[model samples]
Target: MKDTSMPELRAMCFADLNNAVKIIQAHDEDDGEAAEADYRDAGFDNQYVLEVDGNIVGVTGYRDVPGTDQCHWLSWTYLQQSSQGQGLGKGMLLELIEKLRSENARKIFVKVSDYEDPELGKIYQQALQVYQGVGFKEEVVSNDFYDEGENQIILGLYLRDDEDQLEEDPAVSEEKPIIRFDGLFEIAETDGAYTFSWIVKETKKLFGKRNFSVGDLQVGLESVKNEGGRKVFLTFPSNLPLIHSPLQTAGFKYVGQLQNYYEHGVHEYHFTHDLNDL
Candidate 1:
């Protein structure tokens, strides 16, 4: 029988980390520890715990998509294994959406992994269905992103109905320019879907000598590929006109955009390259 009692959502405190971590681990032992550590380090301020009759049953939260005020990413949403199939997860999701909507969040996004194992994939499928039932749209999929067979699925929910599009500014020059890379890091990897990230350390060097070129991007892509990365993701401020063409030319597909991500008019454009296809 389903619990007739309603679950209460309350702000989670740093002290509640142990209990929350236990619940998360009970659901996913492999990734729960890392997720708990991440939440403890960076997510304490924005997270909440779901309590039913004074017992913690789940945890949920969202963080502002770095560089965006109105866009947010759903973080470490997990329910205790014992609580599965009780409809509590769906209710908690709706509550989180309502809370974000009230805060005037323009958009919310979440990443779901499609694992190689059939049983594990069903677990993610349930999660995907819950998000879809609440109007979240599938935006992009990076095949073999986690490893050899697992994939990463990005889903987004738009809180507002406004369509705000910006025109691209013309490139000043078409010549390939020298670019430098730094701070290469692995963003995340689960079930063999490895995603790598890096920074553009020296774009200023190309100011007058030449325009950002496709060759500059190819260099970075080749480096990531050499490192055995399955997918490479990069995000740049929409106002940076020179970076756009080189990205498209290097075969990076536009995954999605975060509105007002950098500022009022400037947005953050997300692009991805599938290393397997290369």
Candidate 2:
């Protein structure tokens, strides 16, 4: 079961370019023209956004890798501070991977920046964990992949074999059945019946026992509820049937399926769509 009110994925528009530039500048201050050029090159098919309630919370784009078996690079991805926890990043990455895989890309590469400060580097390292968790392997290290003094580590992963990395990665929160209705419905401790009942339905659909409990739908809901787009994600006890039709009827697209997300056998399905299209 998923929160019907959550926002979905949508194409990044030309109007969104200026703000997208600011988002990129926040990450890398240098080479604004190059970034803009990359966005322009992508055109309509290149970039996508994760929005909720009419705001762009996350962004990602793809580019072709010439003279290599791999066709494109998942060049950029970002989520606002408010949407940090609750698996939004993971969901976005999975969406991007699905598009790349559909093109029959043998592999996808992401080279993340590494800093000099151990503490700051740790933050990048944590981000690296997310990429690694998504099937991208740390392949090489360069003294300055972005800045003159900074370092960059090249990560690579085979699309077919590495897809499971997402499922195998450790769960972000310990809260059980982190559910949300931020996209389509309001979910709080006070109104738990709708979400709880659906969880039971999904569990029965999966043919698995209801061993897991719903902990925080608001937190989970916030992850997918973007301002301009809509995305749906459902975390269930792995053995259960994961039929999230309530999400589908609400116009969500099944983007990717993650398996073995936890040692205890929890799995998740990530879905996305646009609010206007819905």
Candidate 3:
């Protein structure tokens, strides 16, 4: 039987990064490199490393979601391959949850992938099971998010059940529409599926007689489809009522919302348009 003793969780430091990279690489080489780069660029102020008998075996961390106080995102939760499959992942996750709860985190979220390949699917399945076992609920599944046939699964755990007090939308000023097409970028693609993101730079500009229109959206969608994109995603603050109509007219279906995403009472809504269905 594997030892069930809890591993020591210590604040990660720049000096510990080499060991962390090795631990992550043991599971995924590309991800390990990305994690190391992210740590270097962002720093490890909120990260922690798990140590078992003075040997670094894993790493985990959390970051406050921008524009919110109570919401947080799980970051870089990884364990060495040699240390996995022995119930260590659950223990580490529980510890991380406790840490977040103690810090008064009202909600925590994480993203996992659903891959088309059976072998790759099994890995994420185990991950999803772990998160679900710890009370994480599947909140959103962005189809073709990562690439063709690989979906992004967002899970959330609410530590507190406080009811949100909805706030009224503020009056809009009559000014030139300040919106800009942030650019269309490829989100993910595979042989069977391809997804792209259309980002609207400013919501306030959505109300005025602007260059953006339902027709514009249709053209963009068609252009992407012609280029072989199977899916397209767009997100915006729910407070922008004017934006919703055009999006709906463009045949974008509402996927889900992230509550308290922008501020208390406001939300970020996710919408997707499937080219194949159209």
Candidate 4:
């Protein structure tokens, strides 16, 4: 096992972006905009680092796609080979899940390559054990998803509401039940505070993908003349990057910026369109 006892957990920033770049480069061959895009798309608030004696030895990040009703997606997690066997990956995964749960996330997803190579195969098997141990269930597969011609296995885990925990744990009363939104916000009140809170909660719950944050509102819920307006919330895949132009074509427009939006301390490009404008 690695010397995990000396590792520190902290949020990432632009200054530390180069560290993430190195991690990506070491693990994958991405360069230039591809690497920078990964950092920007990762959101400052959604990325994290595991440091040992002041050097980043591990990285993990979450993302939220804009149109997918702010579904949380797991971007990626990586640890240096020197730190591989010390249970740091499990610890990091737990930290990410717990943080998302507190932020009101309902599901988490990750993609791991399943290859035939003995060495790479062991890595995938270990990753599978880590995710499954944490409650992830196999959900889907993308044929030939990796450069090595490996298939990608997608896994999913559901987040039980706090009230569900109370009932199942037998440690508290069931009267004070926790509430979760079931796609009802479209017709709900549109106070700035509520919208802001919803944005935060939604973003938190839907980390690990690019569409995790709302970039530009194609149509404010208010602008949707009918249920057609609500489809924007469902466009998120819960585990992939966000596509901006579709929402733009739908009617959403640019708004402003949200600073330090996720736990990763990243800024978000906010957008809004008035119902009246439609």
Candidate-wise lDDT, in order: 0.71, 0.54, 0.74, 0.54
Give the top-scoring candidate (lDDT).
3
State TM-scores per candidate.
0.77, 0.50, 0.77, 0.52
Model 4 lDDT per residue over 3-107, tens place: 346454688888888877777567654432354676776568788888877888877878875543334667657777677888888888887777787777755
lDDT by residue for model 1 (1-278), tens = 32346575789987888988888787677667887778757858779999877888889898886656588889888888788898888888888888887887888889888764655545677888989998988766766566666667888777766543334533323323333444455665443223334444434553543454677667766776777666777776666666777777789888776555544566567787877667
Write one digit per residue (lDDT tens) for candidate 3, span 147-248.
Answer: 666778998777765554334544433233334453465552233343334344454433655536787787778878887777788777667666777888
Instruction: Name the runs in model 2 displaced over 4 angstroms.
Output: 1-7, 31-34, 41-44, 117-123, 144-149, 161-278
Cα error, candidate 2, residue 164 (Å): 15
Which residue runs does candidate 1 get wrong by more than 4 Å?
1-5, 119-121, 161-180, 190-215, 237-239, 248-268, 274-278
- Compared with the true structure, model 2 gives a TM-score of 0.50
lDDT of 1 at 85: 91
Ranking by TM-score: 3, 1, 4, 2
Pairs that collide, model 1: 145-193, 145-194, 146-192, 146-193, 146-194, 147-192, 147-193
Ranking by lDDT: 3, 1, 2, 4
